[model samples]
Target chain A: MGNVAYAVLSSDEQEVSIMEKKIQWETELVHALQRSKVEKRPILLDFHNPH
Target chain B: MDTVTYPQQSVVTFIEHNLIPLRVGSDTQPLASDFAVTWTPTLVLLDPQGKEHHRTVGFFDAEALIPSLLLGLGKVEYDSNKFKEALGYLEKLLAEYPESDSAPEAIFLTGVNRYKSTGNPLPLKEAYEQLQRMYPASTWTKRAYPYRLLG
Candidate 1:
C-alpha cells in the first residue's frame, strides 16, 4: 500500500498548488499600475473597506 | 470580498488571466480620489493606460464579476478601434451571462461596434429592440434610445 499512500500525498500537493494559484492581491496601487503597463494588462482595482 | 467572493477559483483565475489585480483600501491616497470611489467595495476596471472603463459599486459573486470585467475589456478594445475584437468579448459576455449587470452595456456597445464597422443602422435597431425587451428600465436602454430613430 506504499504506492497508494504516495498517490494520496501527490493528490494533496496538486490541490494545494491549485489553491495557491488564486489571485494574489498587490497592495501597492502604483506598483500594480506599473506592472500593468509593463504587462499590457488592464487593472482590476478593488476598493474595499477592510473593517 | 476576501472572505467570500475573491477567493472563488473561477473569479481568481479569470482576474489573474485578464487583469492586473490590485486591492486598495478606501482610504488609500490619490488613487481613490482619481477613481472617484464614493463607496466601499467599488470595483473599477481600468485600461492599461489608466482610463476608467467600468465601475460597479458592491460585492459581486464570481458569476457576476467575470462578465463585468469582460465588458470593461471589450470597451477598452472598442476605444482602441479594435471593433472586431471588442465585439468578440461583448458578444461572449452577452451569450454567457445575459443576466449579468454588464449585459445592458454589452448589448449597447455591440450595436455601437456594429454601426462603426458596417455603418448600418440595422444592428443598432436590433440592439435597441433587445434592450427594450430585456431591460427596458436600465440606463443602457435609455442610452440606446436614440438608436431607435436611426431606422
Candidate 2:
C-alpha cells in the first residue's frame, strides 16, 4: 500500500515487485485480479474461516 | 494463519517478490461459492487472467508454504503451456526444498512437465525411479506408478 518497490531478477526484465513491510492483501477478487494482470504475477487467493 | 504463518519473514518476502495476494473469508459470497470452497485456510493460485491452477485446503508453516507456492506457480505456467517456465519453478522447488512435504508432488509434476516438453518417456521413467527411491511412501509415487513401464 505504500511506495511500490521492485527488484530486477535479470536483464530479460524478469523484475519482481516487492511488497511493503507487511503483505498488503487485497480483500476483493476484482482488484486482486487487476493487480495480478498488471503485475504479471500469480494470485495467491486465500480463504480463511475468519472466526 | 494470520497470527503464525503470514507474519513469517520468509513468507512475507516471498509473497512480496512473486505473487499478488488476495485475502477473503470463507463466507464471502459468490467468490467462495464460485471456488467451491467448503473449508477454511484454503489457498488457491490463479493466473493473471484469474483462472485457478493450483489449490490446497489446510494450513502450512513457512517451511512448507514456499515450495507449495512454487509448485502452484509451476502449475500456472504449465496450464498456459509454458513448459520451460513451469520447469524452472519446479526445479527451484526441488532444488531448494527437497525435504518439504510438497516435494513428492513437485517430483511428479516435474516428470510430467518433462515428458510434455520433450515428448520423451525417459524423464517419466526417471521421475518414477527417483520417487520410488526417495519418497516410496508418497502418494505421488503411486500416482507415477505406471511410469515404471516406460523403459
Candidate 3:
C-alpha cells in the first residue's frame, strides 16, 4: 500500500488530504487488479467507489 | 500507449514531503526559473539546454492532461483540434464530479479553451479567479494570476 509514490508540490494541508485519498484509491486499484488477475477478468476502475 | 520525449529531459520534482522525487528546498524561493514549473505538482518541461518551455498548475484528468503533457514535452504530434475535443470530455467530467481532485484543473481548462476560442478573456479570468478564491493556498493560484489579470 505504501509502495506507490505519491507526488505533490503544494504546502497546503488540503493537498495532503488529497494525497491520502489518492493513496487509498491506488491501494484499492491494486487490490482490484489482483482480484481481477485471480478471476481472469478485466476490472473496471471507478473513482466514486473503489470497492 | 505511446512514448514521448522532450527535447531535453524534463522532471516532475515533487516539492512536498513523502511525494515521489522527494526533494526539499527553501519555501521562500522559486523551485525552477530555468525550467517551466507547474504548480500543485510543479511539473517542469525543459528545452535541450534546460530552459523553460511551458508550465501548468493543477491536477489534470486523464483526458486533457495526458495529451497536454505529451504535447508540452514534444513527445507526440499534438493536434489542437483533438485537444479541444478532449477538453470537452474534461469539462463534462468536472460537471459530474465537481469536487473531484481534478475539478480545479477542469475549470481552468474550460476557461482557457473558451478564451482561446473566442478571445473574450472574461471567461478565462472568471474561471481563474474562481480557482484563486476557492483554492487560495494552492500554488497553482500564483500562475493563474498573471494569466488572469495581466495576460
Candidate 4:
C-alpha cells in the first residue's frame, strides 16, 4: 500500500494530527474519538496512547 | 488549496524535505493570525474549502501531532480524563523543559483545548496569563488579547 498520512481535525482542541500510516493513526484515533464522545466535545488527542 | 495531496517518499527523507501539503506563505504574520499557528513547525489542517479546521504548532514529531490531528478531524470527541492526560504531559513539558521552544505554545494550546472541550475558562485564562507573564513578547501573546476566556 502507498504510504498514507492520516490527519485528524478536532474542533474543541483546534488541533490537527498526522501519522505515517492509516493503521497507526486509526488505531489511535478510535481511542481519542471515543474519549471525545465521552467528554461531550472534542478534546486534544492523547497522542501517546499505546493502542 | 482546493485539494490536498501527500507525495509519499521515505518518511525520513520526507521529513528532511519538509514538503508540507498546504502552500504556506513566506510571512509568518498571516499564518499566525488566521490559522492560530504561532510556532515555526506547525501542522495546519484546513477544511476542504481552505478554512482553518485545526492546527498543531511546534509539535516536535509525528508522535506529538497525530492524536491532535485526529481530534481536529472530528473523528474523536472530548474526554475530560483524556484531556487531563494530555494536559499532564503538557504541564510536564512546561515544568521539565521550560527551555523547549514548544513549551509556551503547548501551554496556550492546552488551554485552548480545555476551553473548547470542557467549557472551562479558568485554564484558558491561566494559559493567556502564562504567556503574558512569562513570554509577554511571544507571538501567541499578541494573538491572545482579544480572547476573553469567560463568556
Number of the top-ranking candidate, with lDDT as the measure: 2
Residue-by-residue lDDT tens digits, candidate 1, B1-151: 7877787888878888888998888888898888887898998878777788778898877888899889989988898899998999999999999999889989999998999999998889889999999999999999889888887
Q: Candidate 3's residue-wise lDDT over B51-74, tens digit each?
A: 333445544444444344433432
Judged by DockQ cut-offs, the docking class of candidate 2 is medium
- Kindly provide the TM-score obtained by chain B of candidate 2 when compared with the true chain B: 0.97
Candidate closest to the true structure, highest DockQ: 1
**Model 3: how far residue B14 lies from native, Å:** 29
In model 2, what lDDT does residue B85 have?
A: 95
Better of 3 and 4 by lDDT: 4
Ten consecutive residues with minimal summed lDDT in candidate 1 chain B? B45-54
lDDT of 4 by residue, A1-51 (tens): 379887656864453234332121222334434543454333231122111
Higher-lDDT candidate of 1 and 3: 1
DockQ of each: 0.59, 0.53, 0.02, 0.03
**Residues A1-48 of candidate 2: C-alpha lDDT, one tens digit per residue:** 479897647744443324325788999999998999898999999999
Per-structure clash totals for the candidates: 0, 0, 0, 15
Q: Which ten contiguous residues of candidate 4 chain B have the minimum total lDDT?
A: B1-10
Indicate the residue-level lDDT of B118 in model 3.
71
| Least well predicted 10-residue stretch by lDDT in candidate 3 chain B | B13-22
Model 1 over residues A11-50: C-alpha lDDT tens digits? 8788887666568888887788898999988898889896
Ordered from best to worst lDDT, the candidate numbers read 2, 1, 4, 3
Residue B28 shift from truth in candidate 3, angstroms:
41
**Cα lDDT of all candidates, in order?**
0.87, 0.91, 0.43, 0.47
